[model samples]
Target: MTADKIKAAALAHFANHGYSGASLSGIASDVGIKTPSIYAHFKNKDELFLAVTEEAIAREWEQATAYFKNRSSSFKEKLYGFLRSQKENYDEDERAKFWLRTSYFPPEHLHDQVMKDVYNLLDKMETLLLQEFKEAKEQEPQLNSLNIEHAAKAYIALLDGVFVELLYGGERRTEERLEASWYMYERALFS
Candidate 1:
């Protein structure tokens, strides 16, 4: 339970402050423990940071799995929902914030390690979306000429663009970007 509590506090601190800015002392203080108490659960700050990062990645992956697992939603709903969830989650979820921040703005010292994790997620995401797009192309005659791989990559590109807007473009801009991106995405798939 101490470890879990520590991770919870660490996640918040990391989400708010980032890898370089987050502190074990501050995390421990938030957890109502001494700085040294953290050593009982983590060897060092890098270890603790990675622990939190790994947990965030797992949580995000699970969310995506849940979205893709639902059998009832039409592909368009599922696909758009996935894109929209990026904004919703970033705005409303702390774990999502940490995942986004760490994925894009990792600590310079941990860049290689952080990127390894990010690339693994990207590969998995592409594989899943590619399958979904392939199925969509099969199910919708409108998508007869759609190139599934290109669509998948473009979709992820749109998602990445949305990520940039979310981080710095403010709420109105992020919404506008999402709306425009979705419109273009729909045109690409349906036109």
Candidate 2:
């Protein structure tokens, strides 16, 4: 329970104030614990930050994967579900802000670490997507024209682009933009 509290506090801290700007003391204060007590759970701020990020990423992936798992529809339907899930995931208040901040203005020194995490997450996601794409091709040989890897990358990039827009635009506008992007993606991928 204490570890969960620490992680929750760290998420808010990192989301509100980037890595360099967030302080362990501030996180401890939010959790109603002394700064030193954090050490019992985390070796240092870096480890804590990574833990928070990992948890968030894992949650997001779990949600998406589950959405895909029970889906019993065409590949396009599954892909559309995935896209809608991406938009919804990025629409969350704290999570959306944290992702936007990190994507656009990550700490300079932690660039490698950030990239590593992103790549690792994507690699895991891609494995699942690759299997889906292979099944899609087997089901509908016409989809052979679309390169699965390229399509996956494009879909991911589209979500990232939509996420950036949502960060700048307010809620209503973001929804409109996401819908438009979704339609465009559907046409591009399915037709």
Candidate 3:
């Protein structure tokens, strides 16, 4: 579909060249269409960028939520599964990489929008994590001793840190760091 093609091209362009550097004409050309044809699917470049970001975030959430939904295990198992899922989500596809890059570092003009989007995404993720923490507390009374809010925030921060490190370092190092962080988190929260 033209819409998908546009999104794919936009994502690639945005990833390689921030928002301002990427042009609608270039995306249209990537899709083998005229610049005006993009107007049919998106009213403007901002709309197109937002659409691509929303789609990428939705897909990532869908994958993570689905994985969590099918899992029925102990709270510790669920926690580990969630950590692994978060890593997998960060090992994103091209579109997702674009979204992540923009979320963390966007063009000056689009920085506000990117910040708002990142806050919204983080809020949603925090809500999900808080629910998991609450469930863990209910299932294991020992978790009651832990500060659920602090633990949840720490867990999210740990994932974010690992993502940044992985982007620079390779998968093997990332995995090692992730495991080390996971152990620390598990010991602190579960033990």
Among these predictions, the greatest lDDT belongs to 1
lDDT string for model 2 (23-125, tens) is: 9999999999999999999999888877877777777678768876874777887777766666676665576567557756667777788777777777877
Output the lDDT of residue 169, model 2: 80
TM-score of 1: 0.97
lDDT, model 2, position 185: 77
Model 1: runs farther than 4 Å from truth? none
In model 3, residue pairs whose N, Cα or C atoms come closer than 3 Å (at least 3 residues apart or on different chains), thus clashing, are none
Model 1 score (lDDT): 0.91
lDDT of 3 by residue, 58-167 (tens): 77677656765664688778767766766675675676668667777766767787688778878888888888788778878788788889988998898787777656
Q: Against the true structure, what is each candidate's TM-score?
A: 0.97, 0.82, 0.84
Alpha-carbon RMSD of each model:
0.9, 2.6, 2.3
TM-score of 3: 0.84
